[model samples]
Target chain A: MNSILSIREVSKFYGSYQALNAVSLEIPRNSIYGLLGPNGAGKTTLIRIINQITFPDQGQVFLDGEPLAPHHIAQIGYLPEERGLYKSMKVGEQALYLAQLKGLSRAEAKQQLKYWFEKLDIGNWWHKKVQELSKGMAQKVQFIVTVLHRPKLLIFDEPFSGFDPINAAMIKDQILELKEGGASIIFSTHRMESVEELCEHIGLIHRSNLILEGKLSAIKKIHKQNRYEIRWTPLNGTPAPEELLGRLPVIGPHYDAEDNTWDFTLELQDSEKGELLRYLSEHGNLASFRERIPSVNDIFIQTVQKQESHA
Target chain B: MHKLGLIIRREYLAKVRNKSFVIMTFLSPILLVGMIVLIAYLTKVNDNEKRLVAVLNESPFFKTDFESKRGISFVPLHGIGLETAKDSVLDMGYYGLLYLPQRASLEGVTEDAFLYTKDAPNTLVLETLEGIFEDRLREYRLQQLGVSSEEYARVRMGYEINTATFSGQRSAKGINEFKAVVGGAFGYLIMMFIIIYGGFVMRSVIEEKTTRIIEVIISSVRPFQLMLGKIIGTSLAGVTQFLIWIFSASLLMIAVMLFLDIDPAILMQRPGPGGLEASLAQSALSGDDTSQLLVEEFLKIPMGLLVGCFLIYFVLGYLIYSSIYAAIGAAVDNETDTQQFIFPIIMPLMLAIYVGFFSVFSNPHGPIAVAFSIFPLTSPIVMLMRLPGGVGEGGVPLWQLLASIALLLVTFLAIVWLAAKIYRVGILMYGKKPTYRELYKWLKY
Candidate 1:
């Protein structure tokens, strides 16, 4: 009941090539779930299945506890990685057409489109052909159309591409705002930085299989390795005491002779952080100490590379 | 259902609003009418050209036999030798020189005659000269046999076999050919419309794929719905253009002919002696009964059935062809790649037109015509060619007509189904140049 969408062992094939293989995942309601995968790793295929653009050759998908059907299309919004509006159509007209196709009435589509266009500060572009719009401008229109129907679940693939940093930040804010409005989102992208900033939960797919899935922080915690980095500088030009730091199972220790400073990383056992802190303080002034957490990017690369080596 | 309507409306508006589509829709009729008018005027001028042949007669025969005709004139050379006559004819830029040498008998004189020209003489002019010689020789032979001139005249009269239907309505010569040509013109229009607007459907699919908007749209509507919408919408635009062309072309043709005081019947002529007009005129000169019978035969054509069948065939034929076009559009990334796939789609339509005209015009009930008219792919063109003769009995059998339409419907459904399969996969595919084998694989997908 807590999950807005659930995919159960979905499998798909294109002729002899298998595009998806027994993949299963769930997205909790009102959370931004990052769909992370390398290029050609069945991420697009999974999203397409969710959108009902294509059906899985073998499996079942449920949206809001009901089997996915044509009616579910109005409840899901998908913005593909490669997206476009009709080039010859007027911006507002094209937006209205797409909205209507998503089950909005003409008057409803028009009113909603007007609200979004003004909110996005593109009110004057209503009559301009899409061909005349700048790439970012067109992206803005696409974004509006995607969310216009106010679907229960929104899927965005590479949404930040072709946008400047400022616009990207603006879009990022809008995405946050949509999520705040209680719409569950499936964010698919190769950019890991965006995932770290935005995603609360994630599913990592590699080679047509779900290799990893959990809360982002929980996954990072599991891969923590109890690793920590410490930096210290000796007081009053005292030479660095490498014997004490080395005896503490320190790794890659560095000594800056000019500044009389030392830096190194280490894996500490349970209840051993106090002992390490005492050793560092007794030897030199401790500059910094922090646990090293693996980023989503690191986890993605490690998982994919591990799978590649195994294959 | 609603989404399909929206897609159809959008597609229709997109095509109709396109600059080239609008230009071609209006401008083409004018170009067509202008071309026909130009050809008719040129043909008139060509037929007006007079060919003068100098006749150097050194015999006491054919004194009044070499008569001047509409396009060929004979000028007798007086007190001139053969070389002098040739020189004068060449100097005057005459068409040719006809020399008749003196002999003891008319047979000897006729045998020694020659018509010499700077280049090869025209076949029509040569035939005219030979006809005159044939008549004179016949008369001389009759005189030698001691037969009276009255008896010779009775013997020389031309004979024509009488014709009638079982119902006793007289039939006219060239009416079958005439009806076939008229129906063939309708068939030709369908082919052109299918090719032109079918191209519109194809290009529209390519546009959506290349723009990468197909994925977004399909996420809202089914791919089959989108493909069907495109074909229907584009064909509606085509039908609109076709109606406008027929209306405007007819209006413009009538206006041009009236303002210039030209006879359209003359335009129908083939522009030389022994042409369609000449033979029809000859038959008319024999008696007015034949011309009246021809007019009745023209009116007896089942215009209502022909028109009704035309609309049916036009829709079915275009649907079948454009679905294939839509699939091709989805399979290719750009227009250039379409060249590899376009020929096969067009082959059936071309075969329909060329084969329909040949087989239908010769014998409407012939095996070639009957088979082509029921073959579904070519039926739209060939069936109309035979329908002008009216259905049942002498015309196309009722079973054949129904079968042709029924087969077209089945074929259209089958093609659209297969095409939708390919379209679903191909629109999402990018960059790769898909072979026929790949398309076949997509059908399975």
Candidate 2:
């Protein structure tokens, strides 16, 4: 698949302060790409550049193999972090206006809005003012507007914010539905759970540089700790688990005295599952066992912390 | 083109639906008409305070029961001492009192010598007494000359000057002065609005930038298009509001006609000296003759010219000032920060208004008014006001006004360029206020 959005060595500067430092990344077509970072880590700056809100000092951006131009703006939909809304405007009225700005005709906008409103069960809100809506409800309106014109690429910054879990789930499903229909997405958020649940690819930005990025599963596999957690009967605490403990380094070996269950974390010195399994079977009764794969949240925090301490 | 149409439609709908717009349009006419009626009612209520003064003829000359217009009545009194007179009048609760000297010594008495009340006597009573004294003095003088007052009146010589201003050209005279002042005043009002509302547009842009909404919109629309769309949209809204105002004013006039004695047709129909009929007559007779003192010449401004100049100035001046306003808006984050820039824009407009009032009076072709109006920065308003005066004494030369318009256009373009530079950078800025150096660096970017 073609890279729906590609940033090459993009460096953005505000006066002498560098907002993004030669950051380069690729978002493949039809993927839920998570742009993960701490605050002030240049994620917003990169997003802004891709949206064409501001120009970068040294970079070229390509959208689906075409050089990004003014005309191409219609092909990209954006939801800014601050929530671009005219407060005095009525809800459906502004939605139609913005939809037209995004290149939809009035009739088309109304038709699409009708479908979205019914789908979200907010059809009654059409005549109401946006200011009267609760923050979560307004977010629904904003989210609908973000995807209304159905641009080939959609960029959402903290899209799930100000939403209840039910609405969040609804919007999440919609986002996935968008991706399935071949729309590329750049989802920026501090909530790592969103990245874990929704994103198929992830990029870690720290201090204005792309520290890490890859397919979600591939990145996790690369950072895999080769550790496992096992809960088993310890043979009445007679140190009968030596045969299991022998094959691997016992990072954590503890026993719940009341439950009479033994728990231990082991790291494989080498990728030899046969040896580890054989040792476990010989020494302890295998109650449960599972590999401890690093989560995107853990990796994000670890990556940021590593860079901070290293710098 | 489609986007512009969309913007226009949105702006029109939003403005027409705005309660502020509706209320302002209807409320202004009500307030204006209500104020006129309120004034009339207040005046009528104050018309009933006639002073009832008591006069005793101890002087043996002046008459009692004298009348003084509708606001003063004198009552007869029996001879009384000064102290008794004062106490009786004060106790009686009269508006005021006046005492005259006896007929023998009245010659020695001065107009200021009369005294009775603690405060100044009622003006109506004083005028009546003054008239009596003057009549008596005149009769005494006529007796000394051994001539009757009727004979003296027959011998008086008086002549009135019938001067009419005409130099085979346009001329200003008499009530034309008032008309000129009024025309200037109305033109000044229109000018002030363009400046005020145009500045509002600029401030709105800066506000949205400060809030960061401009950033999201800018992604799909260029800054120039956004700025242009907003300006055009807002201007159309202004005109729309103005039209609504005119409509409401007519409706109010109709309401006043139907419900009250006030005639709406009085304004519409020509009546008496100051009527539009007289104005038309004055100009129609001055064919090929510019020195006509006719009210018609004073009203000679073609409606086309009036509207043309107004539209030209309204749009051109608004664009010019709005650009500077946008620049100021982009430079500052909040309204407080705008104080530094507001004065420059406001002062020139005010100065133009003042200059316009004096344009037709002292020097219709004076350097000050001409200069102000011919300068595109101020011309849109001042020029429109002076156009009724026939381009001024020298009548503003066509080239001069056109040049001003051209300069205004260039200035408008330049200001927008600079404002856009600031806006492109300013929208994403927050927390710390930008310094002059930082703002300057943004232009470099």
Candidate 3:
């Protein structure tokens, strides 16, 4: 896959504390990349560096395979976690100002802003001060400005924060729409569920280091335990034969008294699905057979907990 | 540079469009002119109050000496003692009573003469009474010297030495004081503008920092650009407001003059022949043409040079001080924390005004005035104070003005460089209020 942003062994230090220690990341073009970390895991540090709000003490950042320069700021959009608009400024005026700062012409900025305002149904709020808007409405204005320039790379740090669920879903849909239009997105959040729903690729940083990274499916596969669940009802009111159960690679066998069925979780141990299916069929009438894959939340918790114990 | 322009435009619009800014811009000039008019009117009314004095004279030497003038009237009390005269004056609501004792000789007539009033007598009344007796005593002394009253009167006419410098420049008396006043006014304006507009810039920086919009702005433009843009934009707004004030104030003055049916030339006239000794002496020197001389003296002032220097110094002073204010705004999280930082920035400006008044008035070329005028921090104010003294031939030397400008420019650049660093780091920092040490550390970064 082609990469739009590549951070090569970037390290940042704040005073005596190291914020990012030799952390490298490659964000693929036209894809949603999730940056997941606990609080103080250097997630904000790396994001700020990507936006050039601050610089790295070591290493380099590249955008579109070119070394990042000030002019490249026009191609990037950032919605910081702690976002705000000038409270006393008129909504439309403030929006136009920000858009112009992003290298848009007055005519283009006004035209694009008109389109977004109408699309968002906020057409009548042009002359109102930003302080008059509700938090959700203000967030909508902020979102419009962030995406107004049609930047190639969009960095959203906690974009959904301070939004009602309905608005959050709206922003999520907008983000997806932008991604569909060939914009690469960096979605940084601790919400694993949102990550699972949006991100195709993810990088997990722990204690200033990138500990796990890859395609979401591949990463899950690598962390998978090869566990399967099988439910069966004994035939002729008899339990499965002891010899058959012993021959199969089984770990825990549980019985459901209410359903009068036997549930067994087994380790496949490199065995084929066909072999497991055949063994289940011969033992008893197969009720249900499924592989148990870990959710992103589960993977995140396990990875972080394991790392903590090791430390 | 384009982004900087955008930032400046935004800042300018934000300030100029504020309701309070517009109100104050127009209101201040009216208020200032109104205050001047009120004070002048009250003084005229006070001077018009009539006072009645009753004189009880027992001496036959001077019965016709007492006379009534514009605001003071004297009445003679016959066959009444001093106490009776005082009581009658009080009962009749007279302003005061003047008693002349029948002394054997006129040698101690002034010392023995007395004036009594219900309250403190007006000093002008007393001075007038004393002048009558003094003239009588001088005539008596001149008669004793065998000089005739007419000859004595000719000799007693006030004499004023015409003064002219070696450079053949003749200065009217009190011209130096007038120039000092004009220079002080310019210096005062610079001080006031720096404080007012510098506060504007500081508050603006604080507002941006507090609202957290600075993060979004800095991401697009450098911190230096933002700071410079704010200073320049706010300054332009200030200049706009000042221009409007000048236009409105002129209109208001014209309206007032027409309403009161007063001549504009009379407004420009020097103080009338009243309480001022200088004007009285001037009238004694040239009875009717003192006002003409005053007009000529005013014309002699190099107003063009004074105004040009004022603009240059005003701009340079504002840039230097406002940059410091911006840095302070960035360093503190709130206005309250700014107190510790603000005093140091304003100390030199305050000191310049105070020192400029004393040294620049007494001797413009004094060591203190020259030092403060040359120093970039106080030059904007002190230099204007010294400007009226006129250097080289008759005005501020071109080299001194140029040197002051060059020093201000160099200092402004250096300060802006340091302030930009503090602003960059401090704008994003929250919660913790920084100390001087931390600011120094930011400079290193």
Question: Which candidate comes out best when scored by DockQ?
Answer: 1
Candidates' C-alpha lDDT: 0.88, 0.73, 0.84
Candidate 2 lDDT (Cα, whole model)?
A: 0.73
Predicted candidate 3 versus true structure: per-residue lDDT over A1-311, tens digit per residue: 39999999999886667889999889999999999988989998898888887888899999999988998888999988877889999999999999999899999999999999998789999999999999899999999999999999999988888889988998999999999999999999988899999999999999999988989999889888888887787655656534456645355566676776877777777657788678768756898888777888998899999999999
Could you list the iRMS of every candidate? 0.7, 2.0, 1.5
Poorest 10 consecutive residues of model 2 chain B by lDDT? Answer: B268-277
TM-score of candidate 2 on Cα atoms, chains taken together = 0.81
Between which residue pairs do clashes occur in model 3?
A: B391-B395
* DockQ, all candidates in order: 0.84, 0.45, 0.63
lDDT of 1 by residue, B216-278 (tens): 999999999999999888888877887888899999998999997777876766644543335
The predicted structure with the larger TM-score, 1 or 2, is: 1
The better-scoring model by TM-score among 1 and 3 is: 1
Candidate 2 CAPRI classification by DockQ? acceptable
Model 1: CA > 4 A from native = A235-242, A246-251, A256-260, A282-284, B52-63, B74-123, B165-169, B271-281, B284-287
Regions more than 4 Å wrong, model 2: A228-237, A240-250, A256-262, A269-277, A284-291, B43-119, B122-183, B195-216, B254-294, B323-344, B355-361, B374-377, B427-445
TM-scores computed on chain B for all candidates:
0.88, 0.76, 0.89
The 10-residue segment with the lowest total lDDT in model 1 chain A: A240-249
Best by lDDT: 1
Cα-based TM-score, every candidate = 0.91, 0.81, 0.91
